[model samples]
Target chain A: MSSKYSNNLIKSADFIQSLERGLSVIQSFSTEHSTLTVSEAAAITNLSRPAIRRIFLTLESLGYLTSDNGRYALTAKVLSLGYAYLSSKNIWEIAHDPMDELVKQTGESTSISVLDHDEIVYVARIHTKRIMTMSLGVGSRLPAFATSMGQVLLAHLPSEELEEYFEQAILSSYTNHTITDKKQLIKQLEQIRKNGWSLAEQQFEEGLSSVAAPITNRNGEVIAAINISTHTGRNSRKEIKEKLIPLLLQTAQKISEDLARSPHPMNL
Target chain B: MSSKYSNNLIKSADFIQSLERGLSVIQSFSTEHSTLTVSEAAAITNLSRPAIRRIFLTLESLGYLTSDNGRYALTAKVLSLGYAYLSSKNIWEIAHDPMDELVKQTGESTSISVLDHDEIVYVARIHTKRIMTMSLGVGSRLPAFATSMGQVLLAHLPSEELEEYFEQAILSSYTNHTITDKKQLIKQLEQIRKNGWSLAEQQFEEGLSSVAAPITNRNGEVIAAINISTHTGRNSRKEIKEKLIPLLLQTAQKISEDLARSPHPMNL
Candidate 1:
């Protein structure tokens, strides 16, 4: 394993390096690199072909992966891993109806996502009439400095963690509208924190715009954020701010209330 | 490890037992058992508490899991493992529009699922105004003999695999209407294979009904099944047969056509 994953736990004797290698190998296969040779996995994971082969054999034996023509790819059994997370969270079941209603009311797609380091991971999504050029669905990740949901989540982070995020995150300019400067992004996050919602116009993608509202837990901590996304061609920034933010805020509150009432809220 | 998972591959020297243990440890936390202690995981996986602790530490280090006090639960980062599967399949992307259109046309929820052994795992779903009592969504599993999509998939399975399924699967009658007899199920499968469509009326659950059609690949072989579901209270068998199956078939065909044309149709 590379020093990239080097940390106290990984360095400790109790931490299973094989488990980390296995996960890294699994993650190496992405939308771009859907299928990979053992050599390819070796290159991506910085491990030898023999080591990658053993991991691949183990995963194939476990039904998480399959290989044909010397190219290995993940199987549907791997989905159970994601299910473990989604089902454990139990937020999707409670948030589904309100999100569906939001989609109906707005005639746009809406999703719920939570912050993870420098990115936000979409937990649940309700799609309506959308022809998304950049396909964002459940389990999709976007930079926290660009998307509306990411901004809402970042705005709610504690001071120490937010500082850590800035320290680690690159804040690359994804588009002309992307806030590349840390101070500017932090200031915008402060404004979003005050407003309790955010609107990102062509920040992540040129024609894409979105507005997000924080979904709080019972203790009023922003556990996640919900967003309504529209094409810039279909919606004006002023219109999304004036019309959708209120409804998005209402839906977010409804989901938050449902989550609070839920007897089993998976503490992230 | 249980002899339950005993196979030739597991016995091989090349298989990584730790990787299998880690996956089993992860799978141990499901919707029912959302949170677990080291002792609980040890009991569930038949591993020692020390071993479970090590695995937990490893998973936490990898960000696939988290813990509070002594209780451990999966983290959203685990979603990426499942994303590897979904994104690799590339079917969900092509199936989305057609499945969404099917939901709109039928005024009900629609889903696509693939057969895994005796169960069907949902890969894609589009919900409209669904009040699902059983809570079937992406990555959810249902017994193949009890669900419409399952029957459609079971009907198309190769003879050797079908025989193995019958040998391995516990033919539990989930509901009063569930087909339990192997001979009767085989006969029904034969008919479903001939008919090219299926209507499962309250077999899996009372007051729930669904109709399904197969989605074929480039070879015209059934790769998956798509179904439209509604509450039995809302629709009678005759009405569903007359109204929904044609649309379901059409939707399945459209998705199949799209899958065939798409550069990447994941070979199951």
Candidate 2:
């Protein structure tokens, strides 16, 4: 209790608030509301119209936002910030080479992704041409439960964290194969933890199946997950288990070893 | 001058110094100096130690900058800002299908890049197996002259703008084939404009070749450029010109057509 008082007494100035409010305004935007009138943004952030407009103008001048007619939208210049994170000599770069090797040997669409709140964001991908399918890339995010990468990453979390996740997340079915039940998902994660790998058949998208394994650090903690995606119609789960699993596991192990050796962070 | 003065300036109670100082600190940490001590940040931004310490702590709390072992660096959370931009319908969703189709047909690395000052930044890439040899993704930046996409995009600029660019850019040689001379680059851009596509052979990197065409809006002004990259050892310029030229040009045309067909920004 004394420590809490001391923490509050540490006058960090109003600097953090300004930064947070700026970011909060940015976070107000998403796939659903890509473009917003100034008034709408003000409503979303609970900031005054003048405050939001100032931030918007600053962002637009910096090339992170663009306006046409009356509405403002984000521009690709904003990617530079994320690129700074994803391109750091950290986890994504370490796992990339091994991912390439895995794709070479197995010819499967391999990717390394990390958990972001309730979503799974792909940070790297070694795409194979056998399947002409959905759009996926580094920086692409999807529902955590619907991805093989998500299950393996989720399996590593403590029970308390899992419960908190369930409390926050909505388990909407993306495909017929997607697990909608919260209890079933918890059980599946447990199985994934025991098996050291995860196979999600048509979970995220119909006819698109994937298998994933956790990439651990020196402390044996899961930092990220690596996966191979393919069409279920082209290959069976058994074939993936027998042929792709070992290679996938080896890639995961190689990435884990690399993580243990390197001093840089995986995602940061 | 009258129109410029007519532009509304929004006044916000938000602390502008806090935001500017924080961003300056983030921008200070580049690839060269990813880790900086508080003193280093203070020196870089010409802010006092107490002010910088507060800024760093605030940024760390917001997940933009992380402090550890007496050094500060950016975090993956900073990417959320950029991800918000890519989530916009104008760029990511609109360009996804065409990029995929371009990759399918060309069997080369296809990317959607936009101009950021004198350089071109990759906003998205639909990479083929062979092209996966390199690491380039959303936010990756490269000099415009050394890339086909850069050349095509530069071709879109007015002659005075091109001269100003040459004045500002260092024009260093990334490869032996890179155009270091300003006159030569201007001539090349002019050809790219006349022919409707640009080819870069061993320009950005030795043994890598690429072709790019511009994507324009209904106004016939280039808004972005799409490129196809491949290994120079695998194919000749003639092969790319004969095979990929048509595909690249058609893809750009398609994206432009889509942009044209879409409702005007004012309507939205």
Candidate 3:
């Protein structure tokens, strides 16, 4: 099989197509398609009916997927896989107190997110108030070009990887303020790198705004980004810059210092 | 391949062994073993080195696993699997406000947990005060017999299933107060079922006390349990029973009511 991801370097001999297919079957059950039939899963995964049937049976047998009548849905066992990743990273636990403190000080939702492909995945979050229309939570993903956390993380990426990302990204506009142009996004990223932070105003959603800073490891590599999200209606750009950004940066720095001091390595 | 779980009724012909093996590889990475070599993964999963190599490569290619030198670790992409399960159940979002309210009212940590085999996996949590030594988060698992949520969940299980659980359960003692005896546990479960709530005092961890109530679906079958956990040093048993339990039960009832009123089914 051909590699879909450009970063994948493993030889064909080492790759297992069946395992990937099985994971795809599990991924097929999302919010939109919570319960799926065998044929529905087959269609979603683009696998043969026999293949999807086997995958479903395998997942159901393992207790990750449960069958209700003719439809299949994921059970709580699937959470264990994500928990394994979250528990492995001491960063979430280390940043918890600091994130909470940031929320307390700013009275806004504070989150720590890591760069994954073209999106940023929130790993730790503490909400002081829910101001955004979108229901943001741990494990939620947002496009790297449209969100403050994503911009901070993208700003710190290796030059070649960033260039490749720019070459391949779709850059779809969510709002009129969103940077859909590659040249403009690159310029924004460069400015964010120089400023050591980012403030995105109504980029991803109509009234959503956030200020973010990179959280580095002991090696000073930006492993994740932390942000304070507020509403455009509640807080003006000037007020957010003056009040929230400093506290957000301070909390990010404290978390970075704590991460550096931690004996356990922050699993990126 | 033979089925490891008795409840798995799918024929061996339908079960995809490779899929099971692949999931096992993912499961092998935990808090203790965050990064694993091919040989280490092989040993943990009881699969051959070649099999582990293929699984690792497939996972890496899918962006779920990343390799550094000879060690493999999970990336943020893996969180999407857990997010799929979480997003499927709007209950977490629905319960968020009530849980926050409970935490505010009692000044304790509030959580919702669902039974996964012999363990209760925390699905949602809101911490007002950090009282426990153990760092508890969403997806953290605790023994079903030792935790208040676990007891409430176990109490609501059908008679045959509960009997089978008692028969197979190790019932290991976490603290001296933990009820490890089968007969005594059965009696306690009976009382919990009758009372519609449970209060576990220093059962799982010394000084860690919690009161839990079952959250049922429209069918009135106990799908999950919600609890308010406090420290024994902070509040007496009488105070918790009188004050926290009522609030806990009310929140659970409200959640249940909302769940019943919801158009979408709770995918348990």
Best by lDDT: 3
Off by over 4 Å in 2: A1-15, A104-107, A130-136, A170-187, A201-209, A230-237, A265-268, B1-15, B24-51, B65-75, B92-107, B130-135, B175-177, B230-243, B263-268
lDDT for residue A169 in candidate 2, whole number 0-100 = 83
**Sort order, TM-score high to low:** 3, 1, 2
Q: Looking at candidate 2, what is the lDDT of residue A19? A: 68
Give TM per candidate: 0.90, 0.83, 0.93
Candidate 3 lDDT over A24-89, as tens digits, reads 877787778878889998888889999888888888888887776778888878888888887776
DockQ of structure 1: 0.44
* Runs in model 1 lying further than 4 Å from the true structure: A1-11, A130-135, A233-242, A265-268, B1-11, B130-136, B233-236
Q: Please write out the lDDT profile of model 1 over residues B13-121, one tens digit for every residue.
A: 7888898899889888877888899998999899999999999988887777666687878877888888777676676678878876777777888888887667898
Sort by lDDT, best first. Answer: 3, 1, 2
Model 1 residue B35 lDDT? 89
Identify the runs in model 3 with alpha carbons over 4 angstroms from their true place: A1-5, A129-136, A264-266, B1-6, B129-135
For candidate 3, list the clashing residue pairs, or say none.
none
TM-score of chain B of each: 0.91, 0.84, 0.94
lDDT comparison, 2 vs 3, better candidate: 3
Report the lDDT tens digits of candidate 3 across residue range B1-268. 1122348778999988888888889889987888889999998988999999899888988888877778888887888888888887685657877877887788887888888878898777766643211124667788999999999999988787787777777899889999998889999999999999999999999989999999999899898999988888798878887898899999999998888887666445
The alpha-carbon lDDT assigned to residue B144 of candidate 3 equals: 94
